[model samples]
Target chain A: MALTRNESAPLFSSDTANTLRLIAYLALAIALMVIDHRNGWLVQVRYFASAAVEPMYRLAALPSRLARSAGDAMSDRARLNTRNAELERELLLAQARLNRLQSVRDQNERLQQLLEAQRSLDLGVQLARIIDVDTDPFRHRVTIDAGARQGVAVGEAVLDAHGVMGQIVEVLPNTSTVMLITDPAHALPVKSERTGLRAIARGNGALDSLELQNVPISADIKPGDMLVTSGLGGHFPAGFPVGTIGSIRNDASGMFAVATVTPSAALDRSGEVLILHNLPDPVGPPAPAPAEGPPAESAPANKAPNP
Target chain B: MNRLRANDWLFWGSIAACYLLQLMPLPQAMLPLKPWWLALVLMYWTLEAPDYVSLGRAFVLGLVGDVFSGDLLGEQALRLCVFCFILLRFRARLRFFPMWQQALAVLALLLNDRIVLLAIRAADGQLVPAASYWLAPFVGMLAWPWVFLLLDDARARLRVRDA
Candidate 1:
């Protein structure tokens, strides 16, 4: 039998029913968005869904990897051989440098241990692999393979081989999302390593651009000025290299000048990152209770025992 | 013949496959160019098999897209509802049109959907400028004819098997 619509039925028939159902679903989605945006109740739901979808990502990525391998196998054998030889030579030089660096690092660690013994502080580092780029291009975020299970905490600084990338914004059980320095929502307190001029480095959501905002037009800032984390906010450690000034443009109507910064780190292509877990205590041990009298006078009785 | 059952199965299966494709991981370079693959598939089915597919199905699928993409939840659903409504209303005229003409129409529809999405996103405080955001529809337009042909072939095969 050929496909036919029953004539006696109204035009609104089955199609109309489907349209109504779609409208209902649409309404439900809107309600979900409102609830998610306002209450953050959907984060757990999103996490569970992401976990379910993670395997699909791995499966889809396999074909792309295979295609890349196929292309590598087919192209420029002689050039590949030459490149391999050059890489081997470079590897030898790198190994030599690494050996010397290890010796220096060992000496530095000994010195650091002595200093830490005097000062009394604990420090550590964790490495993580980039898993997925944010689905929204406008949001400069990346998910890393490390998460809460690995002691990866939100607000920890993320760095690449070169310098500071961003901070952990969200931590899941199996993954964490890093909000990069290039995301518009992210702001880091930064200072010029050269001039010591301080400003907030804000992300403009571009691949290579950051904005140093609220700087005086007359400030001694220029192109190529190095920017480093100021550590003023206590979110990120101080003295981490962040970016370098690219261009400074003075606003014609205002006292403030906008300076563009290119991040020192390869923010767009970093496959591996280190999360510095050394966040400083936000509130130093509650100021030792002020003594009612001179410490010598108040503690005279205890002093004999102390001696 | 089991044509009706086969067509129904293909219709539902293709819809699910399209959703799966949307969920698939793509590199940065390929991600932006990935058309609203599920939407395109739904559009195809709605046009080719109006008896089986309808605006409600498209809207529901759009809601799924919204959920999966983590976009403003109702945005995709609304866009899909409007798109399906328009397409269903013009189904007869659309089916008879030449391939190029049909592609142009699809391009217009996709552009409209993108604009609506952009507007809603802007209202939600996203700073998506008009220039870069419009590129997806152009890519979608380019892919439309191929998607149309592929789904049409599947539909024809199902019809033959039914006969």
Candidate 2:
């Protein structure tokens, strides 16, 4: 079975052509990464790759779907009946509450319209579906099925049923990735609903938890206090629920307090979200137009009286 | 030499098939168990046909893996090159080892590959501790025997058909 070196030489010798092909492949990969990171030249490539891989995901999930259906088919009739009865009871209670909320919402709408006359603000919203969770464990990000095609742009605010989730970071033709509020790199300006003290809320990458930075140890913040988006930054709108204060640990240095807040929105389990597209400017308001004419005769009369 | 040529095609084809399987979306529970099919394939070629595949191919395949997995550039490539170099240096002895010993060796190689990846991530200052991070190589080790047997059987059949 031992073959002479000459006889096996062709099988074992390093082929110059194959080596060149491999070197070419390596060079192409490096070039791709450079272009992708520096200039975003590979966005279309990533999009195409995602589209091509999506069908594979569907195909792989087929067995689980079959198993689930089989399990459902074999479920006991009595268990299904009991589950249905419980759901019906819960539905009735929810409907009763919803009826009361409907009337309250109508009254609020009228009040809001009256306020709008004083300062008109136009806003638009869109809905999107969650597609995938972040592949990197270090980042808290989710990919949504909506993308540039759906008018979802980077920096748009994403909100779930309860409150703000995060902002869109990357947008493709058919999908976009949202960097969730719980991402370690994310920070939002927040105001305590009770004290009106403004502080920055930063994500700790722990699901459902965030920390308020640089709050004075003696400040009037307590457990169970609510935090709302302060609208200091134009990134998010004002008055959206952010989180509730969980625990406060006053440092011996007394310079600051470490407070943990439970995020209002369920970051882990949400299936759908609303992308708020109409975010206002963060800096000073738009400048008013110059006087169109010389001082009017009634200008003095319209001016406020000196105390 | 003819027998070697037959195994080369069989092994390379199996590796391609494995890459396709890696693309298939398994259930969430099974996701962690999805083997490092590319690494297994690279290891096979490194051992069975070192002269043909060599260190450079392992490095290139690793780059392809990085692109497919959406990881940072050169992450998998560096790990695979190191793995292949080690395997290549000992290809002769590795080919003669018992099946169990070979699997153990592969497990060690994969563990080193993971460690190297973690080191790179740590250097970049992004660290997350999770048990699932180590799952891929263990699954790869478990799948090694089956992969080896299946490919070996196919190569034998192909050789007979060719003759």
Candidate 3:
């Protein structure tokens, strides 16, 4: 306000003041960014600021939402009936598949009981619609309509109907930002379904692919091998599909192999996602006895056993 | 005093519109083509009304943008401060330039802003951006002329009504 008051005083002083202010603000910004990136202590500041702008996001999304509803309301009766029939058939098929899964899950529960293993938690999922996409071209993030008010918390894994999408990074009162598995900064622990080979799948900043890090040259990985969450990290539950290995090639170092993974989730297209809650802690305390059994059956009661 | 207040309302209102435009959803294919709407609008005000648009104000506006975008705090602030500083330094000459030349200058400024963004990304250890990453500055450059005329018309109308 003082600066505005003095606007017409003189030009010479203003120019010098401009440069001085630029330097001061630049220093402040750099410090804020360094502190923000390193420790994320500035999240509280962002949390409050984002709350103030929440209505702007809604306003921006208003037109598309209206148009979608209008289009839905205008659909003809015949087309609607066909869509209804198709959805009913799809629901029947899904119910059949769920019945099969129910039996398999029951069997698995029995097996876990026999082995005295902690049963996997029955996680809850809240459905949320994508409200906005990140403006930054490099970062793969999206804002969802559900947030802290809806019991959404930071670090909750998000998934579509098909597979794992990403994890919640920031939770506001009525909105949250989900960092997709394709963000260059994200890394997920995944295992091959066939070989149980564990590797860290790092996002390459591309929506279509992830890269498996530090795989050994002789690792039993092949193209098309399904990758699932290993549950080594307590953030995500086990047996959720992450991606499929696309290609494997030796790294330039020749000692390790790098493989690209095609993410199973429709990262760019999915509008609705389920935010998982109450994830099971699969990585229990270290085992006591060194069992000389096969790795497949060795960690039954200890770390996460195959689903 | 009433006239000044009205002009001030226009100034802040236009800036708010720019923020809305930035936040508006675009198809994934059209995302890289979305020009830097905030920067373009800020450049207009900083040029036409230097008294109202200062470096400190620009920095704060960018901080707001950073918060809204969920980017690293102060990232946009630094970029916008540098942008405002440059525009202020060259404001006199830039004000006299023809429309086409001014658009070219806008292009250069937007490109410089991209470099600032690239430096920040590099410092943050982000992955190298894809080729489409370079397309936004050009889009901003092309959008500059229309944006300038539109805002200039709006300001002229505001001044006429105030008079």
Ranking by DockQ: 3, 1, 2
* lDDT, residue A217, model 3: 89
Q: Which 10-residue window of candidate 1 chain A scores lowest in summed lDDT?
A: A298-307
CA lDDT of each prediction against the hidden true structure: 0.70, 0.67, 0.80
Worst 10 residues of 1 chain B by lDDT: B23-32
Q: Write the per-residue lDDT of candidate 2 for residues A192-240, one digit (tens) a residue.
A: 9998989999988676799887788778999999998876666776777
Candidate 1: tens digits of C-alpha lDDT, residues A28-135: 766766776677667666566667545544453455557667988898989999989997887787676666666755675577577663221234466787764344
Q: Candidate 2: where are CA atoms >4 Å away?
A: A1-39, A48-53, A56-86, A93-122, A132-134, A212-215, A250-255, A278-307, B1-35, B48-64, B128-143, B146-163
Q: Using lDDT as the measure, what is the rank order of every candidate, best first?
A: 3, 1, 2
Cα lDDT for residue A105, model 2?
Answer: 50
Clashing pairs in 1: A18-B56, A19-B56, B3-B162
Displacement of residue A29 (Cα, Å) in model 3 is: 0.9
User: Tens-digit lDDT track for model 2 on B24-136?
Assistant: 44444565567777778776656554554665677667765555445565667767667766676666678788998899888898888788777766755664645777887
- Which tens-of-lDDT digit does each residue in A61-154 have in candidate 3? 7776777789899989999999999988887877766666667667866786787754332345677889865556668888899988899999
True contacts kept of each: 0.23, 0.06, 0.60
| Most accurate candidate by lDDT | 3
Candidate 3 contains a number of clashing pairs equal to 0
TM-score of chain A of each: 0.76, 0.68, 0.76
Model 1 compared with the native: what TM-score? 0.80
Better of 1 and 3 by DockQ: 3
DockQ for all candidate structures vs. native: 0.36, 0.21, 0.55
